[model samples]
Target: MKKKFLIVVLTLVLSLTGASSAFAYDGWADSKQTAYQFQFPVLGVSIVLNSATDVDWYSYTNNTGSPHGLSAKLQSPPGLIYDFAMIVGGSTSYFSSDTPGGWVKVTIAGNIAPGETVYFQVRGHTYSQFSTTAPYNFTITT
Candidate 1:
């Protein structure tokens, strides 16, 4: 009876530990980041990358049959290396920030198909500094 009780207690402890470990705060990369639901004319969206390893993700749905016009403007803090990118069908286009507190805009070709997924990611060009204030606005004109 004593041995059975001890084994049961050990099993419970190990199970609890394993369960807790499953939900640990795991950081995300571009490959593993969660996709945020996006629709066009998103405006004045704010984000902060506390470190160079941070990546922000937004996914867009294009339902327009003839292709849609996509644009984004990032308001980046001055003195930081920042860029936003558009990724679709393994193709990429980027807009880089040239000045702090300046707007960086990118125009994507409207060749995207309906029901296709477009991913927008924001990150630092160099991972040495942090961005304290970053806000971006986006639009899709069908």
Candidate 2:
């Protein structure tokens, strides 16, 4: 009986440890359905493109009862290329840059109506560059 109890406890502990490690990356999931939601006008939210296929998603809603302009600006690390995009209503605006260490901006205002939500995606450009030690930061401007 003691041996069986010990095995159960070890299994529980191992599962818990694995679960904790799964959420270590910026506390955000990798899909649009599980994307992290944040308030608009956010400044400098740090994120990482940890792998070649890692894509991060975020959403923001316009609830001001009026149309407001929205912009996504990404600042990539040196020697790495990144892409940024925004989906407002049915319209999509994408921005990509080959120049490392610069800010790429995407703006869409007229497409977002009052009470409408928009989604943003950030990822490595065409599997060109990814960094686990370096993080690319972004800002949502209104």
Candidate 3:
């Protein structure tokens, strides 16, 4: 009976995992879906950048009563590499790492008023410091 119960739990876990992956938002920006949209606890979402100036915009609202902090992890796709960084309000902030295609974690502390629109940008650090461009997946949190 114990072994049977364990098997059932394992199967359930695997099914739920697969379901989450199936529902994960995939693809780039479009007219309706202007940017990669997500709330807290976003799963693996695709972010593609072609060059230094290229970027992916993510939008979220500040609904928490007070200020809330935000962070996102950028992971390289398959075999390629990129230097990931984040900027708020169209200005540059800090980067996750210096290595191309390496994992970059961006952090921000916000005291935004409730119902304010927050824009966070995900960009690649290209061959140039001012312009390192590439692509990867990102998970954001607040």
Judged by lDDT against the true structure, how good is candidate 2?
0.73
Candidate 3, superposed: residue stretches over 4 Å from native: 1-27, 30-33, 40-44, 47-54, 83-87, 94-96, 127-135
Give the alpha-carbon lDDT of every model. Answer: 0.60, 0.73, 0.55
Candidate 2, position 55, lDDT: 83
* Residue 20 of model 2, lDDT score: 20
Candidate 3's displacement at residue 27, Å, is 8.7
Which residue pairs in candidate 3 have backbone atoms (N, alpha carbon, C) closer than 3 angstroms, thus clashing? Answer: 81-101, 82-100, 82-101, 124-132, 125-132, 126-132, 126-133
Better of 2 and 3 by lDDT: 2
Q: Write the per-residue lDDT of candidate 3 for residues 1-142, one digit (tens) a residue.
A: 9999999999987655421232222244422247655654453465455554555666667777777777767777544555543444445555556554567776677755576655555554553322223336667666
Residue 19 in model 3: lDDT: 15
Clashes of each: 1, 0, 7
Q: Write the number of the candidate with greater TM-score, choosing between 1 and 3.
A: 1
Residues 88-128, candidate 1: write the lDDT tens digits.
Answer: 88888787766755667766666778778778777777786
Residue 36 lDDT (model 3): 55
Worst ten-residue run, lDDT, model 1? 17-26
TM-score for all predictions? 0.64, 0.74, 0.56
